[model samples]
Target: MKFTHTIKAAALVGIAGTVALMSGCAMSQSGDLNGMKGGGHEYLLTVTRPNQLHVIDTETNKIVRSCDVPGTFGQGTVEPSPDGRIAYVGTNKWEDVVGFDITNCDIVFSAKQSYDNVTVKSFVSLAVSRDGKELYTVQNPTRKLNDRYEVMEPQLAVYDTSAGLNAKPIRTFPVDRQITKIMAMDTGEVILAGNDVQAINPENGDIRILTLLQNWKRGDSWTQPDAFAMHTLGEQADEFILPYFTIKWNGDPGDMEKAEFWWGMSRVDLKTGEVEQGEILPFEFIVFNFITDPTDSNILYGAFNTLSKHDIREKKTLAVHNMEHTYYDLNMTQNRTIYVGGTSSDISIHDPDTLEKIGSIKLPGDQSTSAMRIAFLK
Candidate 1:
């Protein structure tokens, strides 16, 4: 339980820039994104402020490419294409979405579409479905609702990318009701969670509710109002949850016990709108993205914003990666762990299984990008 802030300035990047995995040698510089994959892996990363995207070779953990986004990152969202060949970013900079071909490291398309009303404020969230046919962006941006505090509720806009580049959103809705997680079923039913599996048909604005638990406990039983957060997962059956993971002070239960929180990670079923059956994490986790076990409902993996794992059958949290502000996104397969999108100018590395800080990652510049959208190219 000790804290040290010795390293100062951008030079910190050089420290964690060295990475060595079971696959090969690791070395990465700034403007590079290293995605996790089997054998050989790489990622084209986009970051906020000073606007740019970096391509990192996972095998070498080194930057192979860096591209300028002009004045974009603050307002645009970047998402990888279905095939992993292209990166798509949508920005309010104008009324268009820019598509970058990662293989060549350049912009290929600037698809333009018109909207009657525009906030013009850049805060955004990007999401790509399992099949990559449906793309979603938070039109209102993920900001603090309290203007005085930085909280906000952004609208979810669904787009049909399977069609033309200018294809429009087939659905748009807010997630605040009984729903805690919202994702597409690819079957025209939107998944939501809360007291039940709620589905909203964007076309007619009709409602469908599926009960996940007959004797469901109220949200207040385990969650606080301010702890509001949500996400969508698993297209096969459509699953979601209201996240309730956080650090609890070490002490005996009772008045002496104290707990403070800032995040939660939950997933819901798009088909049933019911929160899929699963055990809640023993501790709270604040992750931007989490992957569900494609085969089982209990096995779940996500970044606690510091790397984490959980087992539904045992109802336990596997202590892995003691990353302090170094978690971003996660990808899971069978029993493999793949993490991506992290920022901490200084070097930060931990065991993928224990989460112990094995070392740190130092970036080349202070220009660290916060990933707004991401996905494994399957």
Candidate 2:
């Protein structure tokens, strides 16, 4: 079985004048979408400002379905089920999580991380186990009792996906503050990325620090690493690739170059909890997110105001291309074609070898913002 573009749905969500005619087929069992092979529907799921989710067909470059997600405040990240059938998003002002059945364009699961009495916020990244049995996210919570509010410790919240909508966190384990990303490893362990990476046992909630960023030794004045890309790369399915930048402040206010900062990535091994890094370089530009070519780990691609391809071996940017607008997410095709989106209405596609803009897909609507991350389903 291989990934294909087959739109087989047992159910379909009908929105008046929106989401055009989709076949009214019986919905497939909510299972591992990554397992389904042959011709199946492949989509680029994007979430916009004020809680709107647009599902665009990657092949057709058209909006096949769009839905206004209720209760979602700021734009959050979208994580797809293993089968790619459902997209789970952390919304409702990053205080709630919802699972939307992309085929039907309806929510199938919802969990609120925060409430009036208990305020909680998930930092926009969610992880689903490869088995699709558990969902994990770092929850920052606060409890309000009487007139005073208690800031509770952040915890790793786990939900059983099979529990369906309204699935409450079955278990929560204490996690460190400033945790930016959560990833379910191939070994039934969850990786929490922040100041340092940690591997946690899903069954017993035991956590161990996998690696430290300071080991790279760029400088002592480095800031916390912001790992925006949580998904594992294809080449290193058992590893997590985190691209982050560190800022430094020098006494010379006029010397901007001295304070230019540095950027690099930490390639973490999920099973053994090991980490490795390449050369570190100055922050030439702003990169909100980045991805490495699984086929060629030496080549790293970054996205923001410009799309850049840096050769880790060479320790310099191989090429840079101006984008129509800044991007928040970056991914590549099987053959290495690049897909950059998240900031404006469309996704920009570029050649992997040359970093040349070959094509672009303009999404439906005016001023639509792509979700924090884009899911490319085969």
Candidate 3:
């Protein structure tokens, strides 16, 4: 049964109750699950400018399909399904999590974050379990009533992936505000990283503060860490890396020479709950984003006016490669092909080992990428 979902704002209460019930139980549908097993090879999906998702052929560097996501556009992250057949896109304007089918270039699922007077947007961070049973997200909300807007509390929401299209969250638990990112660990604890890192038990909404940067003396006179890169070491790797940068107050904030910027990285061992964070770079220009080399944790690559290859142990850049423009999203494919995209309509490919320019894939329609992911389609 197809649901058009056109309802009056006055009926929100009734719809909320209905959604709660449906969230627990998903009515099974008869459709093609064969594709769920995967057949296609490597493909790239980029959330582009002005509300678009461009699917590219990684081998040929050609756009095979451009998926249209109406009414949304922003710099956010994309989470690929375990099977790599679908892509979950995070967008604030639409206030919904859209799952796009890369094979067919269609929207297979959409979970709306808001209805009626209530509006909620997930903070770029979206996660699907390795078993593919659950979807985890942190939602910041706003409510409108009597023609006035009121900021609401943020919450951690979990959805049953099997729960068909447009499924509401099965459960939502109140969490502290200003959480920017969340990653579900194999231990069933969701790591919420914002001002601080926390390990939260999603089942009961119990939060345990793992560390306080201020107390630990991680940095003196620094800025907030940006936890945007969602790269992992497949299902076999044990360590997780978090990258960010901070500005230090030298003298006057306006004096560039007096003030210094530093790049930092945190390496976390999931099983042991051990975290080691240190300043990786003494000076930073414009390292907008970075990703740790899954194969070698000592190495990391970041994008900006120049591509920087850093030695995590030495806390310095091993090599630097200039770019045409600054990029935001950076990732390495399973085959070890590095891609940098975000600031332009094209994705620049490079050899991860040599840092040499491999080639470039110009996307169709001249759209700039906000978030791009390298997916292996079985």
Candidate 4:
């Protein structure tokens, strides 16, 4: 009984009364529940640079603990609160919020809100709400005349981490673009996708813009091509696929070889945008995120520097698994066995029901950072 959230800036009439009490409620379709028996395994809450939040224990995977996220957090990622005790970290530094402590990982809480002062940065999407108390972040409002895509700011902020340690007040939801994937739907609503993928109601963020495709190709000049990841398998009126990742950028210099660096994956029907017939997931290092198998929502697993798998109803890519060093976020728990963290800090363990590789754990750093997001502290 400790979630004391109170962040406010919201009032679309309480998001239309919580979307009319979650309109019909039946959205529970995210299960394959592999239920592993491996004891206290799966971990890696990392950051390297001058950034910090390390705790890797992927079944003896390594690096027990390292904390101190005072706030410089960027390109956001870190989640907990399904009774895993407490860990809801989302920051862009200025609108800071970080809290941790599930059996002594420390970082109890640190929130700072109130700043519509304008010009803000840092945020690439973060979610945690299904009932783990409350903590959702999505920021995208930059004006550096940028669109080279470094991913940050699309605007969305909601915090109520049980309102503990004086929690609350950072309520916002402003969008026009740049929310790379945010899902906190447990009949509560807030399943935003980006480049343009919407579903909002963080108690009153009330957004509903889902249009599967119109510009997603992803990859070029090095990457920033487009289409990263978005998941919402089913429920709330059934029928949900909505996957993403695409890239395209026509060049013009008389002959830039017609410019096109191919990469694809598509599935959308968010109640009639009807775009089916897309599949393409291969990587040479540039696919930063992908994970779906909250049981078996058609089984999808990606890490785009390589560490892949997707079967979204046989749409394509059943396995891509090529790692001795290459992974940076991959999760599936409720017992479906699969936890992979990367940047060569190494945290691998698979078998998300037959994507089988079985084991790996070696994180304490030797080099390489960013792209390590995992949670499971039962």
For all candidates in order, the CA lDDT equals 0.46, 0.68, 0.68, 0.52
lDDT tens digits, residue span 102-168, model 1: 5444454344444433342323344456465666554443233334433345455667654333355
Pairs that clash in candidate 3: none
lDDT against true structure, model 2: 0.68
Question: Where is the poorest 10-residue window by lDDT in model 1?
Answer: 20-29
Number of backbone collisions per candidate: 50, 16, 0, 35
Query: Per-residue error at 349 for model 2, in Å?
Result: 2.1
User: What lDDT would candidate 3 get against the real structure?
Assistant: 0.68
Tell me each candidate's TM-score. 0.57, 0.79, 0.79, 0.29
Give lDDT tens digits, candidate 3, residues 182-205: 666767787777666777887788
What's the TM for model 3? 0.79
In terms of lDDT, the poorest run of 10 residues in model 3 is: 24-33
* TM-score attained by model 4: 0.29
Task: Identify the candidate with maximal lDDT.
Answer: 3
Residue lDDT tens for model 4, 88-160: 5555553566776634544545455534444454343556676766677665444443445234446676766
Off by over 4 Å in 3: 1-41, 92-94, 214-240, 247-261, 269-274, 365-369
Model 2, 93-128: lDDT tens digits are 778887776766666667877766898887755888
